[model samples]
Target: MHQALLVPEVLLEIFAYLSIISYTQTTSTQKLLAALARTCKIFHEPAMYLLWTEIHGLEPLLGCVTRLHPLIYHSGTWWDDSDEPWTKGVEPLSAHEAHQFLRHSSRIRTLNIKSEHPHLLSVIPAEACVFPRLKSLSLSTTYLNLFLPHMLHRCHLLSVDEGLQSFVTRCIALEHLCIYTPHDVHGTANELISDRIHWCTRVVTLSCPILD
Candidate 1:
């Protein structure tokens, strides 16, 4: 009798379970599994459901991942400041790559990157709207702009300088928009965002930004 051969698929499942334990929150581990699943199809269902169903990050409130699933997402602001010694020449995850990760998420209907790091932000390809289910967007610090023309149910304006003004001027069907900016900037751009709020209508709620 021949010995049974262990399938690579089974091994991948084992690896995924092991990798997930190291994650404290649900997001990173799920993301890792999603990445693994991309290597093959057998892992798709398990990986997508396990990881894509929900995502949590260090923030104050729920974010983009919430749009995909209505699960309780803890928002605690956490950052790793330790500088790992240079190994070979590996680079940090790129903005493009981060956005691509969402494409594979298969369940990310919302995206929240509203951290203080502006460089962590990047544009999502118009064609790469993997989350056709996407209905909401939240920025890390409102330092970015939205060029994608798709209609959103709710759009949270990141606390930015001039990006919000630039954004308000574009959204035509935007029903809900929250902006976090300086009082002066808001006062100045309020006219602009309000001007375009509707061809002839104004927004429902406007949160006044305080000067720091």
Candidate 2:
């Protein structure tokens, strides 16, 4: 092995570059990191850290809880209908499973959930802050109630209202928020959001949908 590769900083920079390049390639960055993670113990932590730094969906995080394996497999098709039977008969995570879930969840810095998956609500650990190091989040309205308790620095929201209020009051670290409402916001809803925004001075950047 090369001497420079022995240095953690050098390895991280090299891996970081690989992550950027993979964005334009057919191969994903996570695949490359996953390979490095399995290569040796020295490469494992950094590789896994970068791999879990930013995640597109909750499945990868939820997969850590061994009890949820069966539930996650159905997630690909589960987003279509909230009333689906798949959400039924589900079990909550055991204390040990919740600890396992937190181990990986703590690594996620950015999380984006495109659609709502109700099963997560039933399976998520009751921890107050699942993603302790999370800095950015992108979520559908369906997820607002599920994830609002976690603090974040930046957020992108698909729907708005009480969810918006939760973010304002609970996410004291929040500096940026972008909201896109599928339907135009009107009446008291507009005033309520505006008032909340006025009270939360920590937010430096905010983009809200056109008010009616």
> How badly does each model clash, as a count of residue pairs?
12, 0
lDDT of 2 by residue, 93-182 (tens): 566776776677777888988644555455563335667788898987566655654468898877666656676557877889887765
* RMSD score of candidate 1 (Å): 11.2
Q: Estimate each model's TM-score.
A: 0.44, 0.78
Q: After TM-score superposition, what is the CA distance of residue 2 in candidate 2 from its true location, in Å? A: 3.7
Q: How many clashes does the backbone of model 1 have? A: 12
The lDDT values for all models are 0.46, 0.72
Pairs of residues clashing in candidate 2: none
Residue 161 alpha-carbon offset, candidate 1, angstroms = 4.3
For candidate 2, the 10 contiguous residues with the lowest summed lDDT are 78-87
